[model samples]
Target: MHRPALRTLLGARALARNPARRAMPTASHYHRTSNEASTAMRQPSTNTPRPPSRTGIAARIAHQLLAPCVLALSLGTSMSSHGAGPAAAPERPPAGTDVDETRTVAQRTRAPADCLSVVLEGVTVLLDRSELSRQAHAKPTQWKTEAERMALIEGRRAAALLQAAAPAQGSSPACHPVTQTLDGDDQFVVLAHLERGAAAVLPAGATQPVPSVAIRYLGQRCGPLCGRGSIMVSIPGQPQPFMVTHWWAS
Candidate 1:
């Protein structure tokens, strides 16, 4: 082996033995690989959730704040609708009940009327409870002078007696006529009338109070000794035709 040839052969053998050195990674390569690895680690995994953005966070907060307000508004609407329902109608009093407060004062919008335009002797006549103050004697607003009805008189004994007065209602306009009438679907039922704050009681020998009306009998011929009676206007929560219980008449 000559000197130059020997050196060349030795170099070739060294290269072949350390073949990985020829492809050995450099400092720049290591740095670049390290940077790539760090970048990949910093990136989020596909399954991982991202932090909410400003717009998303703002939207979520707004929804939370408005939820209660929307609920409250809906509740208020429901309550108001319920509250606006119709009012209940007045119930009728029992039959054969009556009161006889027969006087008056200045009327109010809902004032009790003391007059009735009724059929007496085939003529529509006006019956009224007039003011005692007309005489200007200041008779205590209303003196309690009820008709002593121990033995209830006959309401219809005289032809002039009211057909049905036990169910008379309080008069408004202070002089409205009372009549037997009920309101149902534009149809009418005849109801008797009793003034406001009127009630009835049992007769002399009777034990318990009877739901009856005290009716007055007035007429053109039946003078001095007028007629009065007790009548039933209702029964067990049901409206009844005027029933004459006891009476006295011309």
Candidate 2:
């Protein structure tokens, strides 16, 4: 009776130590389960998705946000870094050639009307009103040199065109003059041609001896900056003169 009682106590203790063994699992069963759990922890399932790294996320963001032009510039930079040359852009006009660069333009005048407007053959010109009036009625200036005499003669002729035309307003789209700085001031000059010519309009206070073509001088003649300029116009027998803008280095 005593031995049986002792055996029953030991069995109760063994049951208390392993209460999870309700099915009375064998050693092999435990081994198989341990191996499966370790393997599952070591290797994730193939179908499970992984989170992206920091670098990969940044690259995707940049690809979405960058523009095509930015990408092209980046490509150019990259090529240059790899000892490849980049294409050069023009900085200034080529020398020795009178470039018909009508594209190069100064500031738009907003129709300020700094100079007086004069029209001959329907083409308009801007000039100093006082200077034109003085040149129109002035006596012969002393001929210091041939160039000086020619300059005075041209000024008189230009003043005549101003005197012949009445008070008028005109605008030119082709007057894309270049701006140059001299004596702390900016200067620009332009020339326009008339498509057709009309008989001289002899209004009040007109200048005499109108010619077929007239050359006007704005600044001092022959300057890198706009010190002076001369332009010649060929007139036609038509009634109305339409201005045609021509751009040249002045």
Candidate 3:
């Protein structure tokens, strides 16, 4: 073989014999790989952003969820209160059973019985006793001579009896014939004139108390006597009609 060709062949054989140099990694290659990995690590992650604090994250979520719940609860409470309030109660109650139910002062003063208006002889009277007396006092009674005398006797008897029995309502009867008049629904006047002699004669003294006059209606007792405007009466029934005197006209 030629010397140059032989030399080339020998070098190729030597290069093939030392394969480690070709297989081994270079410093530059390693450095490049490291730089690429570092760049990937530095990039922003796909994961969500971190909150300023754990509590901050929780608080934000809670606020969003809680606001609607609180608002809903408040609205529900307001509706409940409105539905239960007094404006919900009824008006114009019907007559109840006759079992004498107790009532408050306001109920008694504001609402009275829805009584029937009835006529007695020539006069109209309220079915409720107090109303009848109230109307009678407003108008003067024009009685015949005999009727007048009878009225005086009746009035005297009532005064004497009340005075003798239980007194506290008045010192004297303060009785007189009817003068002024107001007819209650033009119904019956339950009350009559004052006793003639009784008005002039004061009771024996302050110690001698005048007894209250008792009037009967539907089997119920009413009044010390109806005058000045008011009556003490008993309502016998359930959801009870409040006991009261008609003091309005007076």
Name the best candidate (by lDDT).
Answer: 2
> Which scores higher on lDDT, 1 or 2?
2
Pairwise TM-score winner, candidates 1 and 3 = 1
Clashes of 1: 28
lDDT of each: 0.32, 0.36, 0.31
Residue 195's C-alpha lDDT in candidate 2?
11
Q: Which candidate number would show the highest TM-score if scored against the true structure? A: 2
What is model 2's C-alpha RMSD?
22.1
Regions of model 1 farther than 4 Å from truth:
1-5, 18-22, 26-56, 76-250
Q: How many clashes (backbone N, Cα, C below 3 Å) per candidate?
A: 28, 3, 22
Model 1 lDDT tens row, 58-143: 77876676455433322212211221112111232221223322111111122224543333222222333232112112212333
Write the residue-wise lDDT of candidate 3 on 28-115 in tens digits.
9999999999999899888968758988877787666645543332221221122211121121111111112222111111111332
At residue 68, candidate 3 shows an lDDT of: 56
Clashing pairs in 2: 219-228, 220-227, 220-228
Model 2 scores a C-alpha lDDT of 0.36
